[model samples]
Target: MTDPNKSLWTATARPAESDETSHETLHGTHRTDVVIIGAGFTGLTAALKLAEGGAKAIVLDSVEPGFGASGRNGGQVIPGLKYDPDQVDQMFGEASTDFIGRAADTVFELIDKYRIDCSPVRQGWIQPTIKQAHLPTLKRRLLQWQNRGCNAEWLDADRMQKLTGSPCFVGGWIDYRAGSLHPLNFVQGLARAATDAGVTISSQSEATSLQRNGDNWIVKTAAGAEIIASQAVIATNGYSGSLLPKLRATIVPANSFQIASEPLSESQLNEILPTRAVVSDTRRLANYFRISPDNRLMLGGRGTFSEPASLKDYGKMMADRRMLFPQFPDLKVDYAWSGRIAMNREHLPHIHQPMPGLTMALGFNGRGVAMGCSIGGAIGEHLLDSRVRLPLPFSEMKPLPLHAWHPFYATLAIWYYRLRDQLEN
Candidate 1:
């Protein structure tokens, strides 16, 4: 099977010494103040924060850094959750709204602080209106962020065309705080930063079992390695598995697919996203697109329930690209890949400490780049000092009802959403 993890980011990202240093199979016994499983953005961020706070942290991952969605995502650092500010306030009180409003800042701040050379671009993010009826919702969303002192702006059809070079979009809004970067490089940078800060990271060391041992938690890895720590964190997001059956069942792993065009000429790039702002449409199954640092046009959206074996499976998404940008009807596809995103029933990130000294955070619902980092930092702070409050409230581990049949349910939901999106078009 073709490895879908080899996305555009991996193909183009510069090699990092940290990745080389951290890529090793775990063996023998190890000890730390905190042990973290899954070295994606959340785990690495938490590890870096913990190490900076003078705590010993050991990070273990089934694969190398950015091997999962953290490296394979759309790279759009979108702020906030799927819900609007008011909806968030209603659901989780006023503090969460404030926290979410500044989520994307975490990404940029980390990039700046660590000097991670990930092709950071902070122009902004555009949420283009796919249907006329979505305009009101877009306007309301813009106003809510504006009221919260966000750098939000309303874009009429003319202005939208000027910014995005796509005439199909009627209107939209741009959040200046949101941005894009080389996601894989960013995650690798995080790994390097963590390692530099005295954290130990091991790759290809899948935690098989976790147990309470005396005053510490013992984590057994696939390679027969053991790690004993005062605290443990399960940072596996969409790639979560049977290490904790209930935790894995709490989310539906939805595959997201993407394709990148060959690097465009200056003229071609000018006719597309000239300002370099990343864009995602206001559709049920939203489509995200951006111009990469190399000037390749990239577009991504929901993929099939089953894993794709080859590039031919991306036919529909390629068609979507042509439909949205008919001017580039003959654009050559240079790269294609897919990765899973954890979708929660509530569409909000869940923080659970099912037991003392163990923390589990997952289900970013396609906003892992920004929100994941925010949540990870918060968890790190909480671990350092128990009185620290998390952005999201800790909830009981409630597995979705009929979780085993999620594939069947997800297929139906995708079909319904596709039909509705077509109707809207």
Candidate 2:
């Protein structure tokens, strides 16, 4: 059954929601220097950067820019991968070490220079230790980041509880460079800015197929709209679809849900997250949250059994939120939505040169906001100068071995975690 809520994109034509209803061209053929697929961050970033470099990039989105996860995420601007800095360095050879290290810092720098006003707040990030044994891993990661010139400081258990106003965490670490944003607004701003920078963007233009012609590639839409270009960058990531099969195997699209509560009183806000810091417990299956601008707690989690029915059902998400903050156990949730994230089994981002004249940037594993922004620029520069180095040591690898296992594994995993969360934590 087709999802009716999925068509909501057709109406939301804002920069935040993939609005470009004004430029929806039907039954037309166009040509450009480069054609990009998927208007989420990757596609938008590629378009913006390529256009600024004097390349005519025709950005085609099946829906609209920020229509997908790019617009509906937790708005976190986290610095690095889900791995320790040293472990990340060892994944790729020594030659890519410095590049990966620099990338951890550059993601935030891109967000700053763009002046993206998605309610960005530099309140820092806290990775609260989920188990007592996890404290060693946290300490090891901190030292690793410090060795790589990252400004990370380990917080004791007392300090962690005091800062968070919750006794759920054993210890944590603070990366001062990390922050958060209003996701939809941020994506909208990026699309608008890139369009203003000379990138021709088209919404409602779903890419149906891609084929290489002599020296260029042709991007065709279901409506028969065509764009021919010398180069193509598939930034579809989690939504790569048939445009690339390898992406489907290597990047699995997983969903996470978020619920935002009605604003709290001044006293209530201070008692909840006084410092305004974004927090996430250190778990393979994790819960992430932060205080919204209006003082509502925006909480995100992974184990959603069903698509919530209404706003009232969204409020029930607070029951899960209370697992961390007992203070706001009965918080009134105002809005709720879910977004899909692309996770590489390896948990590292990839830059793929799948075929000649094609490059793919994908797999942020829920950290796509900052990762996508920086990768867009990195890919644009590389397209401009082939010798340009990226922060990640990436290569094109075959897609997942058994694709059908994803949905089943996803369901079973969620069920297992719910049981574990009930019994253990």
Candidate 3:
């Protein structure tokens, strides 16, 4: 099996690449107080917070900022995680639960502080029911969340049909805590802010080697620059693999895809999603889609590693779009692409100390937006504060078994999911 070449997120939304790419190249060695790898959400957030806390940050990436999932996402700042609140509460202790709940409450806090304007639409999120089997479970989940002081509302079938413009959904709930954004623009804004704050950010430069040197940590880059900082952070997430030792085993790289449609006519757009709430269904392997600010239907779901050429499955995306929405089943196809996320075994964020002065953070399990920002900022404080207070959920860094069976096991599990999706109600 090979990595999926076809991904939808890559095709439609894009960052202002020329802005970051055309900058001068790195030729000589440089130094800074902090060096951040992988200019995605996590790295940029860390850089910004580090700079804010009176530390100089040097950020390096294999590509420009927002070149990865940070820019290519469907732009939904949906609240919470793939897991329900109760599940999250159970996974972590009560204090951890409170910490996570408070953490999510601060997503917009960073946005407001940084003045990020990626077309933020804090209009909340919904999970439309594609079948009846999940109605009860979803309803229970809704009440569970509501009981916890959450602003969640379970709509009746009539409301859901009217809101979704389709009778296919039996019913669904809306969590008012979430919203959407042009992720690329949001990430770009973060990068711009970090740069302005004196963070020395360099694109197209990769961290080639990392080692310990007594009281300092040394980082060598492909551009030949060596950074000796009092502390080091491995914020590369999934991409941190190989370049940073034991980084790959801490998480699983799940392949995710997305597709976007050409903007619909005004009438058709209103006919489809008038309220413009983001949506994902209850399927184990599910389809998550939302109407863009310009009225395009952006849909994402499915994992891929091969036959990637088929990811341009615009036809399939449209079929499902029409099947559920039906109003604009005929919407014109436009963009398609995919990317990878670091999914942890526990489906929670992980942070650990690879060495005394070094730290590792990864595995948002797909909640990169809020969790990434929270982790980045919090970990920045952790490093600056000498790791006195841990910021992430997992206390220890447990590497995924690097046995030869990993890829095989992952592929088998994905295949099993493909089969299970068919059998899932």
Q: Estimate each model's TM-score.
A: 0.97, 0.89, 0.88
Better candidate number, 2 or 3, judged by lDDT: 2
Residue 42 displacement (Å), model 2: 1.5
Output the lDDT of residue 141, model 1. 93
CA RMSD for every model?
1.6, 3.8, 3.6
Candidate 2: misplaced stretches above 4 Å?
1-23, 93-108, 305-316, 416-425
Number of the candidate with higher TM-score, 1 or 2: 1
Q: Which candidate is the best by lDDT?
A: 1
TM-score of 1: 0.97
Instruction: Give the alpha carbon lDDT tens digit for every residue of 101-167 in model 3.
Output: 5554566776788787666677677887876778898888788778878888998888887676676
* Model 1 clashes, total count: 0
In the range 1-425, model 2's lDDT, one tens digit per residue, is 12313322222323433543344544677888988888887778778888888888888888877777887777777777777766666776554555554543564555566766667787778888758768888888788877877777988988888777777888979877677777676677777778778888788888888998899898889867889898998888767677666567887788777777667788877776688878877776788888776567778877344555555544435666787778767776556777678877778788888688898888888888777877877888888778987767568676776775877777786678767755654
User: What are the runs in model 1 whose C-alpha is more than 4 Å off?
Assistant: 1-5, 17-20
lDDT (Cα, 0-100) at 217 in candidate 3: 76
